[model samples]
Target chain A: MGILDTSPRVRAAALVAPPFLYALALLAFPLIAIIVISFWTQSGLALNRVFTLENYREIFSSPIYVWGNANRWGVLPLSLFVSATVTLVTVVLAYPIAYFVSFVVAPERKALWLFLITIPFWTSYLIRVFLWKVILGFNGVVNTGLQSLGVIEEPLSVLLYNLNSVIITLSHAYAVFAILPIYVALEKIDRSLLEASQDLGESRFSTFLRVTLPLSVPGIVGAVLIVFIPTIGDYVTPELMLGSGGRLMSNVIQTQFLQLNNWPLGAALSIITMLAVGIVSLVFILLNRRWLRGRA
Target chain B: MTYSPSAAPLIQLRDVHKHYGDYHALRGIDLEIKKGEFFSLLGPSGCGKTTLLRTIAGFEAPSSGSLTIDGRDMAGVAANHRPTNMVFQSYAIFPHLSVAENVGFGLRRDPRSKAEKARAVAESLEMVGLGGYGARAAHALSGGQRQRVALARALILKPKVLLLDEPLSALDKKMRETMQVELIKLQRNVGITFILVTHDQEEALIMSDRIAVMFEGNIAQMADPETMYRRPNSRRVAEFIGKMNLLPATAAMERNRIVVDVAGLGRGAIEPDQAPSGVQPGATTVGIRPETLSILFPGETTDRRLAAGTVDEVVYFGDMTYYDVRIPGVEQPLTISMKNLIGRPVLDVGAVTQVVWDERSLVVLSR
Candidate 1:
């Protein structure tokens, strides 16, 4: 009775309080901890607990922290390049499959096709990454098949333990994330719009370009963010296929925390990566504002 | 405007049939729409009116028949290549585009300058009464505005034939009526052949120069609106186009006339044209429109034949009131409509009355 007799505003706050506190405890507190630690100094076996900008200074001035060097690119820029490439490849490959499921498949069979798309997710992600290693390894199926067909004299050495392999693995791993949003977008399109496009003097391909593509921009934006954001911080693919060549920003952050015992530096780099992702995502959204916000 | 019967047909369909797997959608449709004619395919849902329109628009290819537009055979022609454009029932305005961009979309390949295209878009929007709305986002439009945009977009292409698939069905009744008048005016202004598909019979009757009443994938009857309404070829067509009261009767053909013994209303001699679906000498049903039968309100005099009846029910409309009168020997109560004019008192149930009906208004349908 006491709770029920409360004012409507108080009742509303009471209803919202549990999830808000849970989020503050699990999510916001850890983020706040990271922010506080990022400003601190770490000494051997102990945190100095004094606010300092030395970590940020090192990140900006250090040669190793540069995006690239004369011989090879640094981990930060390489990670950015790899994730961007992965995002592009996954989105491009996902679109036609999404289109097929949404438009070509019969209405009754659509659920089945969408369910089949999720079959890749049933296996453990690490197992999926390992499967990619097997597929793209030196003696893997592609190289062996080419060798068996006398198309190659030896297995290709460029297939694994590199950024290219990392990109390939991550692209395959996050393909479901790209496909789902795009499929939903394509599915939401009114079928009559295509006919209207054709009736308006557009050929089938031209209709796709003019009507279908423009209408699905929301889905494309969603798919781009879904595949792009978390992939920049992905740790599994680069670690599985390892070397200096395959190491990424996440790997460097892991080393600072585990090997160098410099939690503050690691936290600072983590914050920097988050900032980069936020900036990139914000810029991407701004670029697509005409498609996303204008019509909506 | 002025439609000449001798003018070559702008659109023609010969025995058009559409089969979606096993379900036959359009069956043996033969039609010709003349240039500058407002033609309608009127039917209930699933009667294949939309399918026939789609076939004409080149969205659906007929299974075993030929379609021609502007004297050219449409076989193997894609929708984009056809001289036709469609205003979809859903309006289908591209949500990502502005009103002007949507209207100008079909003009992409035109050799005109960009300024010319823009002018054409503005003109098209103005024609649809959305003149200054070109800058508005398409998605932000109301239902009626979206309809105008769709009409503008389709009309801007200036195709030889414009197909409207139940274009006004999405609007409210008043808005639909308003758009109907606007569409008729626009069609006259453009001089393009319009083939509309609709289930609303009143809309069809109001808009079409001629209407083909379809039922179960068949064109039951096709004629001018007045003929289709007054002399329906079958009881199905009669019941579909409007509220028709059918009385069981036996018709015998005399030379150039049908002598019908209509139950409850007694014997009448109708012209040969009144028996639209030719009458056999045996059993049949005669269709009477409610408006043609009026209750002889007190002091009303008419030379038409009268039948004694009791008012079983009364429904009051603002302008007209309908009475369901129970007549002797009639299977169902015969309905009579009366105008609520000055000095005419509204009749109540159980009031004794005489109903006036004309033999000229009777349509004899086969039993």
Candidate 2:
């Protein structure tokens, strides 16, 4: 007999089957195909169906490919480092704002502040990035104002086309994404818990650190994933702000896929990047679980 | 750790006024609670009982008056710094912690070592009758168990005062009764002042040494439970606290005495001493508790028995029988209750009976 022998069970399975099949076809099947192709080889001017490790060997053997691959490897750790820094800064900055909106602001005015925070995103993303570029450029507004104010005699060359500009632009763009989830988490927290903490003789700072921060971890995790995952795969902000020297893994994948026509190699690099991000996310989930269990 | 027998009032609120925008939440409340008395602020919803409790707990700042604890002014004291704790109505157990951690949360702030904190947590759990359940998560506990954990959390602090905001309202009837008895014993054991806010009059009368009845942002009366129930100062208090059958009456001064002619019961002279402060000679209202009225047999003396009424409905409540008597000329029928000692109901439906209550039971209030 099938597992759905009961009527209710069959009905439930029927209800769930469409979404499950769609996820398998759209998400799981493509991911598996990409992973399989990452290990295959392609011949000159045509596709090779043969399974081989030549692409992997080519990636590891040549000095330029090796250096470029090593540089690609640098994107993983560097992106993670940048993302972590941005996540920390975002959390620290967003918490008090979320706290104020949730606890202090009147219910009517809370929506206004939240709307103001989101208004920046109504403008075009490309325009916002370009605005940052104009502001941070060598002879842009910042330099012109600095020169006019006599802070420096000439425009500073290190202000644009660097890692600092990439981090700054990405952090500013993704801050709203981080704030919304954290604010939701803060709002869902029971006000009685805060009152209980106060009644139990905990100082406001202690209550926030011990109770509010820990309870809002789900929102923090969501914010971290939302900001970090996209920032890792982001090409536009870094491309616009960092110029050619500060290209990330996404830029390299774009070049290999479109410019060089090395479909298999680009696919391999894409799979590698996906695998790296997956591992980091899995580690975070496991760590969060362990911390929660330990606290419990 | 022993308090002096003649120790001063642990909590004192004088002319405390709390105004939220234009609405007055607490109006010029003055109260003093003794060191170890189990005091209750009892009222219906929105009558400022909870506001008064929160003000005493330092959660609110009284607008126009002084609040002191242990003879020290509590003007700028925050809730965390005050030597008091509260058991919230919702229990508010930290869902992320174990029962042990929830109980020991406040104690962990002390300079005690980890072992001392653990011991304190264990002791508190044991005191609340959850001796070996410290490792259980707070969410895993039942409602009554969560209430115990809340009480333990507040009591573990050993504060000078413990405030409870409708602590027993969430429990079922059986659990509520058991918790009331256990709380009284616990208060006696701890010997700390407990100020509770509750809308349940029976719960207040059962557990508190003194009860303050609040009405519309003001304390209408404060006295022992017996006096507050028997000699309520106003009609609102008599109606709000318990079951009272209020009958409209016309008062007249006759032979230097105030005589009130009730609608159903004929004219009876009210003792001038028992008349309320603002009683006029023309119109008034008289309050009588349901239990005070009794059905008299035919041969019984008719001295206090003034009227005959037909029984409209008889409600058998297992321990007592409530009879709704339909008396003539009264808009609302009067209720009378009799104890069901031998499983016998008080009166049959549609049966005519004489309703009698002693003169002392007739509490007259002026309109």
Candidate 3:
């Protein structure tokens, strides 16, 4: 009976309102607050409300006399490299597992297999990382086993407390995310296409090379994006398991906020890292699309 | 039929039975497809027509019996090594490749040079009437275009046999009809033995030179289109192929001509060949095709006998009208198809009409 009640625009707005309001309250507010704080000047023992670009200037350009040389090349790019490496390793390791579960495992057991894959998630994530630390520590199971086997006279110090350990820990932590997308992509492919390839006189390997591999690219790309974006900003894994040699972008930002007590510099660092990550991700996705389109 | 029976067999199956775990997919299939024949395995779903086709294509290995293709025993031969190509029901066109790449996919391991392979792909594409569409992505093509691409892709290998699993089923009605004729022409042009598996009896009749009608994993009747339509071996096959009016009758054999006492059309003598599976001593049924029975227009006369009936149902197609005429003693109405010629008028429902039928057109089926 009412005009607004019957209006499609009002109905659509009503449907969209909940998620939109939630996003505004949770995501946009913090992001805007950080951006605003990045421009405000903060002095020692007190906070100054003076608006200035000094925070951004310090983070973007090197103060030639700065004390910290570790981040002179910028922690964002190094953090990106670590995350990219972890994503590459995780995808390379996860792909075969995903392929095996999707194509090799029997249909009735598929749910059990997938459930097994997600079993690690039931435990707390921080506990999982510390478990990895225990597994790879200097006097950990691996080093102790090697020493007891007479392969080493003492426990080796090369296994933990480094970027390599962090990479291993992060890759293990994100295995499920990488496997799920690839499995879905592989599962979505029509089985008849494989039969068609075989009927067309292609060998098993050649069919995989020509048809199976190409069709599964979308899933692999999805896995890469899902694993890459979050691990770059992952603060806990590197913080608990690594020294400064493995410190990532989040660690640097955290130090600025907590220990150094420079909230403005921390906010500017966070914003710069977010922008760089966003731009790089956009470039990656665009390049993949163009390349995939051209190939197809 | 295009293929001469005396020609060397292209494919042969001897008691080919397939079982998928607990389900019997193919139960003792015995068939021989001659060279250059447009053969179709026609059946409803779950009748194992597709399973039989896959067995011939080497995608499925027969559980018990043996198969031979081109005089070679195909006992352990894998699908990739078999000299047979298939066009899937889904038209399984590779979505990630260009049209040219898809058409040339089978030539990847050929010893020929790049130029020769390219020429072969172009020629195959041209054969399917997709000549200049090589640079286009395969997934971007329309359904008809996709079927054409699938045909070209399968034919590029020049195999001894091409197994098509309902390739035109995905197309719209207009496209399906057009492709059916195109497919027949393509089969003749390539001169390769083509075995199509389809559930559409009309499609099977229109395209196949010879068809194998299967029911519950067994071939009910394998004959040329005309014979399959006119003289089906069983009542089930008769009803499956097209609308057949069946009347309960009593039959007794006298000499070569079997005397049948009918319920609707009156007693008459039918030829022994008309009783394909032999007439039983007890209850029997007589089948007549819709096109074989015609409704006589006012004042029209026929050399054949006549039966008076009332039109119970009238279904009008654009060029033809189907009239279900219930005769005096018949329980169900007999369907008579009348072509809507320029001057011939369409009959009305519940109208009194005279049905024209020939004794020779009746096929005696034993129950």
Candidate 4:
């Protein structure tokens, strides 16, 4: 009679219907549409009613497609490696800053440091990448100044339009992305735990390793996922800093969708990219859970 | 029981002064703690009892003066390097570690192989009565078990002294009492000097061999628990340590005896042979513990001692009965507590009764 006494079937249906409808309208329908279009012939009459693997086979067999696939796979590992290296470097640099902010700086001045770290993010992302370009270009300020100061005889050719340039530019642009989560984790740790660690006969370095580092794994995981996942699919930084040789999967997807005028292949490529990212992220989540469980 | 006293005190704090900016946190404090003694620093919040414990643990360096443990100066020594460990009020168990891991944290740094570490961990766990709980996460343990883990962790290091910062305040009443007895047994078994900081007077009185009563960042008195309860040195200590009835009195010398006149009661002088030293002839306060006062029936006046009063209020605790007696001309009512031996309550409200106490039970306090 009352809402609390509602039947189980009705209650379950009531709880699930709205979200299911929203997902169908927003996500599942679009995905089904893409998959349906990926199998269509040139006439667009859905004549290939039988589900066929031709679209995938054609993309995998062609040389250009193969090269694109190779480039995509190549960028996947390279981007992940670059992101990991940048995360490690950022953590090494940000840890002391975070420690200083948490322990040395007065509470009143902490907001100032946070604001300074966040000020760069307020600027346009593209403009920041462009500024890095101006600074790292052949005739840019860094090369001219180094040449004038007699630090170098010629402008450095490796500073731009390559894998290193993309990595450097992306690292600089997303440095705060790594710092904020780690800072939040450090802030949430109890101060009494530190004192207890000291009172329990642990040296400062040992305490940091045993207590502080293990506790910050969640934040470190977040930082890695935030930087690595996005960087794998990024086209802007690589396109602006590196030319065709450094182009990633996102760039190829863009070309297939717009320049090649092949919607079905583009859809297939998009699905493949999604699958790769999903698999990598799933693996990372599983590993992180295991590590946390072991620690716990 | 054939324990030998150490040649020097296990812990000695000499002329210790600590200041936080302009606020003086600890005055010049000198204390000597013998080996295997259970000492307590008892005070209200902000009374600097915790600061003294922290200073002993080497967490907070004293602003001035010297601290020595076992004849070694503690200057510039960090907490990890000191010969003392503390059980924090919060217990401070590592939520990520298991119960055994929490207990063995201090011993992990020992120069031992993995098997040895595991053995030590098992031993400590067994010592804390949690033998088979090595794999239980700390968060899964109850509060009492967590407290035991903290104790085992501190004791595993074999420190010269163990400091507890209100460690039992987090437990419920029944658990606290159980832990108190267990702690006493553990201390006796371990034979280490244990210093506890607490604001609970009953806890200090029950567990400590000696209690140092602190007030306003200074120690008011220090003595054995019985002496501290019976003869507190100052009015502040008398009020802080236990319940006392303070009555206004004027003192005068008569026949070499110290005479005192309570406001409502007639004048009486302490016998010259039994008078305290420095009993000046002037106005003073007389203090008597509530339990020392006895109620007598009407027409039961004694020769020189009994005082008659009307019972204003009676509180019936399960174990004891408390009465607030208002005598004529006395501005404040006198409190008296009697053990509830009989099945019936002692007196009804508004009943007239004579209150009597031994002359020696009265403590005359100077301003």
TM-score of 2: 0.91
Tens digit of lDDT per residue, candidate 1, span B216-308? 899999999999999999899999988999999988877766799999999999888888888889788999999999889899898889999
User: Model 2 residue B339 lDDT?
Assistant: 82
What candidate 2 gets wrong by more than 4 Å, as runs, is A1-33, A60-73, A294-296, B1-7, B250-261, B267-273, B276-280, B297-306, B343-346
RMSD of 2: 3.7
RMSD (Cα, Å) for all candidates, in order, is 1.8, 3.7, 2.9, 3.7
lDDT of 2 by residue, A1-296 (tens): 66567689787988899999999999999888777776766667666777877766765665433244543545545666767776777767777777788889898899899999898899888999998889989889989999999999989878799878877788888888888898998887888899899888888889998799898887888888888788878888877887877667777678877888777787787776777788888888888887777453
Instruction: Order candidates by lDDT, high to low.
Output: 1, 3, 2, 4
lDDT, residue B220, candidate 4: 84
In model 1, the runs with Cα more than 4 Å from the true position are A1-18, A244-246, B253-257
TM of each candidate vs. truth: 0.96, 0.91, 0.93, 0.90
Candidate 1 iRMS, in Å? 1.1
Question: On residues B132-227, what C-alpha lDDT tens digit does candidate 4 reach at each position?
Answer: 988988878899998988988888888889999999999999999999999888888898889999999999999997899998788888888988
Cα-lDDT of candidate 4? 0.81
Cα lDDT for residue A244, candidate 3: 56
Local accuracy of candidate 3 as per-residue lDDT tens digits, A80-109: 778999999999999999999999999999
Enumerate residue pairs that collide in model 3.
none
TM-score of chain B of 2: 0.92
lDDT of 1 by residue, A16-62 (tens): 99999999999999999989999998887889888899998888777
10 residues in a row with least lDDT, candidate 4 chain B: B1-10
